[model samples]
Target: MDEFAFVDRSKTNAEKYVLRQKLFGTEEVMPLWVADMDIATPECVLEAITKRLAHPIVGYEIMSDSAYEAQIEWFATHHDFVMKREWLSYSPSVVASIGCAIRAFSDAEDEVIVMDPVYPPFYSQVRENNRTLVIHTLNQDEEGIYRFDLDRLSTQTSEKTKVLLLCSPHNPVGRVWSYEELSALCRWCEERGIVIISDEIHCDLVYAPHKHISTARIIPENTVMLLGPGKTFNMAGFSISTVCIPSQLLRDKFEIERKRVHWGDGAVLSHIGFEAAYREGRGWYYKLIAHLSQNAEYIDKTLSSTPIQYAKPEATYLAWLDCRALGMDDRELRKFFVKEARLGLSPGLSFGKEGSGFMRLNFAVTSQTLTEALEKLRGALQGDAYV
Candidate 1:
């Protein structure tokens, strides 16, 4: 394995080990569970944060016009989508924004639709707000690719459905939804007056041959999109997210909630990080995606040598490994890796009921780290977990 390819080693070492110890009770196990990248934030982002650290005070911050401008420019340059500054609102985190949207836009009894084996936060945000949580399970063909069953979704959604929490360039499974699929879903929601709250936080991490389309770009004005640099730049600890609302009515309602709750603002350092990443991190982002693609391919090749099997991920750094052939429940299998192999991974059951017999791995670390993890996994598979 190439040493330089393991960029995340120096930067993510401390957090990575702490997570490993927490999950598997030792630093000996390589952690590939968290969504955070093992790589350092770009040099530009690092410099900006350091420069801010030099200043003594960390005071209350109002988002600079330059910060907002950086966001607008990023979307236009990379995504080819344009937005006015007025459409943007700041939130501390996208998950928080999701809960707020559920409360402010939809009534208590209204249903919010999401795909199963989705980000776990989506499940909590819906149910915690007293809204009905409805899941639309994606169908998997013999090829192992997960595809949305629109007919099934159509049957599930009704006039009482008030929102759809969509994940584009979807999480865990890593599908950058096709234009046709997005358009059909958008039209269905638009016709029903059901608002679309797209958690497109993972929009920038799409792999080759896959394109991420903003659902609002294809649908009506009722769509609200959540985007941020936290995931793209590996700056989740900074805690900043942008909520994009196209409709004035919906925007006003969100503002009313914002005022009542007194949501916190992004840190000054976080603002600097965001500006630097959006303005100068484009090349770094491209290289990072290339590295991730190689890692995903590595997982594919490694799995073929063992009893484990998985379909290639088209987007995101996550690989969804189908461990059904091992004939163990997700919980038991996850335990086998932790106790037997000393490997930590995100269990499929955490995503949803449909995720049983599956495991999600994050290959965003260095090639060297992935190799060790895979070797350990190979050793684990030889145990009763396989039989």
Candidate 2:
């Protein structure tokens, strides 16, 4: 009955645990990598999935319109963006939609703009699809806030540039773009005839006083918004998400690619669970925000005097730690965390060149787990005396 309870995923064959040896070269470190939460999935989602199993047939079924409606309603209520049923379609995952959209919107060799230090898949999808990549680096201001320079972005594109992959409430660096920022980016992309693909999976996990504005809301006709309850309710195991394409022309193109892949209406249980997550999981979702906000603040305070520097993220559960003060190359940084700190965190260099001298820590764990991890980090730092 504890709303902030977390489950032990170590024995569950979860990727985060299973890949420790392969990723960090040791099973000794506590994994705080990967984006999914160690917090329990919402009870309402579990109950709905369990109820669906009472029927023995367990057959393939189309995702109910009501399930999509639940999402539409959630979006309107939370983000202040209303969606038409016609604009939405089922996707197995947001990354899958990004791949399909890449193929749907642009041809091989055309440029797709991706901001550096974004989710790694954003880079891979473009390369895998044979599209050229335009890397736009986001710089942090003196206040340690990550921001995109419009003037610099303007200098990076050309006629061959066809799409912009935007991570609103961006991953790794964790910035929730302001309304003025989103509006200006949309306007810039629109005038340049670029299709904006906004990935808003973390839309609902944002902290207080910081609002997540849907990019599609700014210029509906020019955006392809990828959304889902996977991150919000910790149900990524369901492999369910929705892609919203407001432009009929883009929808037709995306449909052609979607059909080619045949990522059919997802599973029946996922449909039940997705609906319950949005419609009935509000209480659990709010409690998670409080927990994550506390963790973010905790990291900010904990690392204030340490060699590592951390800026409390405006959104998402990720903590982007500045390790430049430690004065190690990326390889040493990775080694230090694995061998010295006994923590498996995401090395920032893997995100992009701009992520150098940084590491990402996932704070969506029980308070006790977070406390232990931070203590281990502090101990490691004190022992190394790297500063």
Candidate 3:
């Protein structure tokens, strides 16, 4: 808790930095926009970094066997999944890896399919690579739950659809996909010979009663699963990410491009953090999840009583709030909260066209922070704009 306390405080500090920089020199709102947690690094991670710092020699380092083992063992023990060292390829971050994969395997004009309202970076990667962006928006029921439309995806996939960027336990929506959904998705891509790049960064931080189904575990040969401790351990600034490609041929192809673009180095601390987090920090992770789960429940209850309604998240600290009851556009709604409520949140449209009228809130802060933000949100809803 002590370690993560600093992280939590840093969010407020970031908000202060932005708020203090106005032309009028007036301070503004608290920021809960970024997906990063307010919690500090776990004690085990801090001890590792501290020990590394004491060495006084932060030099270029090779990826360690223990680092790989740490991730391998964590998967086997926690998710009933096993990974081979041969499949492990290092990347500085997932976004870089996504770009590398597209450049390595697909042509300039090939299509990269991603679910709409996905992590916005996915959209950026596809477009930036000069590839066609094929978005198949998820279907939502009347109750506001998102459902996978396999038929829609199948109709979209073709020979030119060479890649599908899959977000397991999806962001913004916080759905821990079922085994059936994953299997069906893999089969869909497999039939079309589309490569599957599964981003499972949030797999480790899942809330209880919802199991994270790793796509590669079910269909290892065809999928490349991306996993890292950065998001799980609140170490995103460290920028350590891993790509598990079961096929050696595919791994070699990715490596050729990853090295050419220099996406495979300079995250020494993230590697150390990853090793320590997986090897020696199980207890801390358990406690962290317990606290985050409590926070999710509190938001669920708070939103239920207010005009805004949130589907209780099955995984991830992000809450997908349905603010459609207020009948406000995404931009106006976002500004209303930022100004009136004094709370900063991620606007839904930033995720995708499908995210309009919704907002994504980070609930990984302290309970006090969560309470204060919710109160402000309530006040914002009662403003004349909403009235």
Best by lDDT: 2
As a whole number from 0 to 100, the lDDT of residue 183 in candidate 1 is 92
For 36-154, candidate 3 gives per-residue lDDT tens digits of: 78777788998998888887777888889889999999999989988888888777788888888888779999999989888999999999999999998987878767887988777
Q: In terms of TM-score, how similar is model 2 to the real structure?
A: 0.98
TM, every model:
0.93, 0.98, 0.93
Native-referenced Cα lDDT, model 2: 0.92
Model 2 alpha-carbon drift over 4 Å, by segment: 1-3, 384-387
* Stretches > 4 Å off in candidate 3: 1-27, 384-387
Is 1 or 2 the stronger prediction by TM-score? 2
Which pairs clash (backbone N, Cα, C closer than 3 Å) in model 3? Answer: 4-39, 4-40, 7-38, 8-38
Q: Tell me the spans in candidate 1 whose CA falls farther than 4 Å from its real position.
A: 1-28, 383-387
Error at 170, model 2, angstroms: 0.1
Sorting all predicted structures by lDDT, with the top scorer first, yields 2, 1, 3
Q: How many clashes (backbone N, Cα, C below 3 Å) per candidate?
A: 1, 0, 4
Residue 232 error, candidate 3, Å: 0.7
lDDT of 1 by residue, 79-190 (tens): 8888788889889999999998888889988999989989999999998889998899976878877888877888898788999989887887888889998998888888
